[model samples]
Target: MLWVDKYRPRQLDELHCHPGVTDLLRKLMDTRDFPHMMLYGPPGAGKKTRISAFLRGVYGQGAEKMKVSTRSFKIPPSNSTTVECQVLDSPYHIEVSPADVGTGSRDTAIVQILVKETASALQPAMGDKHVSFKVVVINEVDRLSHQAQAALRRTMEKYVGACRIIMTANNFAKVLPPIRSRCLCIRVPSPTNQEIREVMHQIAVNENITVPDDLVDRIIAASGRDLRRALLMLETAKIKHYPFKANQKPPLVAWEEFLEKEICDTIMKNQTPKGVIAVRSKYYDLMGCMIPADVILKTLVKMLLKKVSGDTLKSKIVTFAASFEHTMRLGAKEIFHLEAFTANVMSAIKQANTSQQQGGRAPSPSGGS
Candidate 1:
């Protein structure tokens, strides 16, 4: 499949992020001082990508061995491994096997097997004098049970040789306090539109996909700061023409058609920007192809350029965009956040006009750019 997985970013530099995180990961790699880490972030972000790269860099072939220390290699894959993490009780060597969750009915059976087997099997590894950390990497940490977590905690403490446990989850509070307390938490934030745009352009060239210049914003907008999702969306956009890949390939989705069905009607008539923003909020997550809040802002910027005089909307848009970027960075709520953003654009233009009209300085409040 081109989507959901195939377009995953494989390199550290390719990660959609600010420079600060890249710097931290580099330092951790240099010193091998990574503590048991918990990575929390929104969906489709680069949490998994960075985690994989960090581990690969640190533990790759011919990688440096830790000094005067012991380590337990724990890599959680969907398949079983021969790794020593579950060597004793798990003859197959994967703590949680797919069979456990493969069927709807057997989930608890799988969890129990993992908790019992992993807890006991790890005790001997803790005995190694040079071992300093029994590192366990659990994916979907939230899915683990209260019982599973209880058993897991003992291993962390009893295995004093272990440095820590690193788990990834979309929600942080679901983790037990004992587990959370033992490690430092890190948040992997979403990618920005600019970051997503670079990845999209690269994807278009690599895959020979076509997207309109304006719809380039649509692609970036749809991905919601997720690099993997963005690239995968590009790939999927091509595949949606599948069966037709040999003939009658479809044009990339247009900017307007890609907007919400409701927003489309309002915006085409050049309705109030406040009214457009108000309506888009209703179906924000429709069918995985609808535009995002940030993208809505961009689309409106395009509209302002077309609708207003001297394109006075340009300077106002540039300013509003900066504020919206920060608002998203702070994890603002979408409906209220977007409403405020659209409302401000309308108000700011009014202020600029007021300053212009009253003795060359007067104002009027209007929607959008």
Candidate 2:
């Protein structure tokens, strides 16, 4: 059991930050006709935790008793193939990740099937309570294909009366406009440095561990403002090196940052055929380590943008990054698109330099004799 899961807040009051959002949610529970919610924010910012806690608040302890099960659904028309999906269901509600359903056109069918199933079912009677609708939490809604999103929009509208949806996404813009307009968009911003530190200290107290103040500071800096990551790092450090030494750094490997900086430095130092070949090998090594190609590309872009100086050059590189990122999303082979991006960046840099040199070496006023 990870510390993140162990210490996860079970109620709204336990949230470390976003009190305003919590207040809004509290009011929403009081309303008889609360609209569907869409919580979007950066990763590890407590969107999932908050939503889970909110559900527990609205329903009861039974909401927390979640169990995962996989079920297969027959596709329409010929029904030759089936799409299997795992759902986290509890007495109060169920959670689904549509992206997990078998890939391709079947993904769209998964959304439609889930919506239909939820709409068709009616809640069982409870003592002194006769609720009619059940909650359905959809995580990573943005990852669903456009076709699936369209189906979701329709199902959401059709079943709006029987089922309540709470969609969580990291990128709100990627979500379709129809869905966004239908749900109440809630933004969960990342926690601040102070908020993260306080939560970590509280966790240490609860665990009966004595983490030094300086060490806590180090953890905060390394956590990148993500409370879940901070807690995990604290626990990792405790397991690796206990006794809580003063000024001890968090035992985080930071492999992602290291890889990003190494690749970025290599590109900045040399933009040539030989350099491209060398960087390509490094990328392969990274891939061998199981780092996803999209993650690699995103990290490299962040580092490369920092290294690039001129505004024009930076803009050009950004355009290249955006184009390659979209291509990576559309194409199956990520390595090809990522490597192509690196080559394109190298070419852009070389072109910028050539243009600068030509402009600087303007033709002499007098022709050569």
Candidate 3:
């Protein structure tokens, strides 16, 4: 088993980070019935972990006994075509995401149909008494179209008596305001470097492995504040070499290295039309590797931020990256936006260099240009 799964917290108290969030969750459970929740945070920040722990707290051991099943639902009105959605089912809750159904109008139908069916079903009795409602966990709720989100909002209101909806999303802004108003929104921030270091040491002790302090620092830095990635990097390091060297670099995922060396370096060295075309080909190569367009754009921006010097240039790069990313999300073709962002970066770099060169040749304020 992978270390990430093996060491996952089974209960709320077992969670390593987010102690304040843990305390709040425990207080909610004390109520016996709590409001619907939306847990939003960056990837690998333990949103899913907290959701699972919360479920376990509510349903006992039965919540952990999960099964995966694919079910098809017929579209309304015509009732001709069908959409298949995969769900993780436990005794007390069902988890599904609209993205699993695909992009477009179908998501609206899937959201309405799946939640209606699950919520309408009768809840099974636990040991002594009947559980009043089931929980529907909608993963990545932010990815749903506005129409789909509207349908979800209605479903939440209609089925308030039958089930609770717990959603997980990376960006809170993408979720509709109506949906936000109905649920108790919780933001799970990424772990700090100190918190990450402490967790790594604990895991190392449990595994009976010795990790050097410097090696741990390198892993933490490379991890981008993602704890899951940090743990995976540590495990990979162990497999690659034991009793590690002091100067050994932690392994970065291939895509990150490619973005830094092949793409970012190329942009910095040659900011020309020809350079943009060359980088476009590399973007396709990354897409071929199944890396998401947003991820590629995000990583490229992060790398370029480090290489580019002035504050003004950095701010401009970030603005354009955000605009392009938002466009990518709304539109169908990712390649166009990806190329656009690359070209924009190249132009910015060229302009910055030209300004610097002119500044170097220009006379001081006391003299002439």
Best by lDDT: 3
Task: List model 3 lDDT by residue over 126-158, tens digit each.
Answer: 412256788889999999988889888988999
Task: For each candidate in the order shown, give its overall lDDT on alpha carbons.
Answer: 0.53, 0.80, 0.85
For residues 51-143, what per-residue lDDT tens digits would candidate 2 score against the true structure?
888877777677788999997878876788887889988876788888876445787887787778886787665212345678889989998
Alpha-carbon runs more than 4 Å astray in model 1: 1-7, 61-135, 160-164, 208-210, 241-369
Per-model root-mean-square deviation over C-alphas: 12.0, 6.1, 5.5
Clashes of each: 21, 0, 0
Best of the two (1, 2) by TM-score: 2
- What is the per-residue lDDT of model 1 for residues 88-188, given as tens digits with 9 covering 90 to 100? 11121222222223323233334333444444554432221223233445566665666556655665565434334556777777878887877667877
| TM-scores for all predictions | 0.49, 0.82, 0.88
TM-score of 1: 0.49
True lDDT of residue 20, candidate 2: 92
For model 2, which pairs clash? none
Tell me the lDDT of model 1 at 254.
Answer: 56
Candidate 3: Cα lDDT at 59: 76
